[model samples]
Target: KRRLEDGEDVLISGFGKFCVKEKKVRKGRNPSTGEVMMLDKRRVVTFKCSGKLKKKINGK
Candidate 1:
């Protein structure tokens, strides 16, 4: 988590990779109010399973 916060990616070899991605500010709408609002740009953490992990999960 700290590495991701520091803008560094973390990899666990055969497990997976954790990365931080930036999202641009954009427009969004509320489902109930139908009011449009600007969403702030922010960083988000994402995960991508390694090929080995994927294969294991798929039982292949």
Candidate 2:
């Protein structure tokens, strides 16, 4: 959490990596009412599994 807050990527050996990403604000529409709206920008955390971990999980 702290690493993510600091915009740093964290990696766990034999596991995966966590990184922070910035999302830009954009226009959106409501599905039900068809009303146009502006989506707020925000930071998001993403994770990608290590190749070794993926192989292990797949029983390879």
Candidate 3:
């Protein structure tokens, strides 16, 4: 959690990896009113599973 908060990539060997991604500010529309708005820049965490884990989960 601390590494993720620090925007670092984390790897768990056979499990997978965790990464922090930065999203630039962009224009977006409100679904309800169709109004244009500026989206704020933010950091997001993403997870990618290892092939070994995927195979195990799929029973391959």
Candidate 4:
């Protein structure tokens, strides 16, 4: 949800796919080697929450 709100692509497990608009290439750092890496732009997936589902959680 935060990723979608930030206009960034998000991949969801079990779900299909979603294309993010205004995609951009990103540079990241490697944890082990501490080396910088480049990440290519790609599509991502996201899910929408249902109001009924929220109500059920709140009931608990």
Candidate 5:
């Protein structure tokens, strides 16, 4: 949210508010009951790499 507000898309690996998203809902199965269930959408934190970081990893 901060990043978006700042008009920045790049983010580091460890810490930042931009490294998150609202996960979408989907169908899933319960392991214990072997029954189908609807999974609710929720916000989740995630990590994404910048182009510079990707280049460094590939170069190595």
Candidate 6:
């Protein structure tokens, strides 16, 4: 949790990898109003499953 808060990647050998990515400020649109707006830069966490985990999930 601390590492994630610090924007660091965390890996679990047989499970998956958690990546901390930096997103730049960019333009976005509001679906309802169709108005353009600027989004603030922020950190996002993404996860990628390991091959072992994927295989298990697929019942391999």
TM-score per model over all chains: 0.94, 0.86, 0.88, 0.54, 0.54, 0.87
Model 2 misplaced stretches (Cα beyond 4 Å): none
Question: In candidate 2, which residue pairs get closer than 3 Å at backbone N, Cα or C atoms, i.e. clash?
Answer: none
Global lDDT for candidate 5?
Answer: 0.66
- For candidate 2, lDDT tens digit of each residue in 33-52? 99999999999999999999
What lDDT, from 0 to 1, does candidate 2 have? 0.95
Candidate 4 local lDDT, 1-60, one digit each (tens): 676656775654444334356547999899999999998886565455455655666894
lDDT (tens digit, per residue) of candidate 1 on 13-52: 9999999999999999999999999999999999999999
**Candidate 2: worst-modelled 10 consecutive residues by lDDT:** 1-10
The lDDT of each candidate is 0.96, 0.95, 0.97, 0.63, 0.66, 0.97
Off by over 4 Å in 4: 1-23
Clashes of 2: 0
In candidate 2, residue 15 scores what lDDT?
Answer: 98
C-alpha RMSD (angstroms) for model 2: 1.2
**Which is superior by lDDT, 3 or 4?**
3
Where is the poorest 10-residue window by lDDT in model 6? 1-10
Instruction: Candidate 3: list runs displaced more than 4 Å.
Output: none
Error of 5 at 56 (Å): 1.1
What is the number of backbone collisions in each predicted candidate, taken in the order shown?
A: 0, 0, 0, 0, 0, 0
Best by TM-score: 1
lDDT of 3 at 12: 99
* Residue 43 error, candidate 6, Å: 0.7
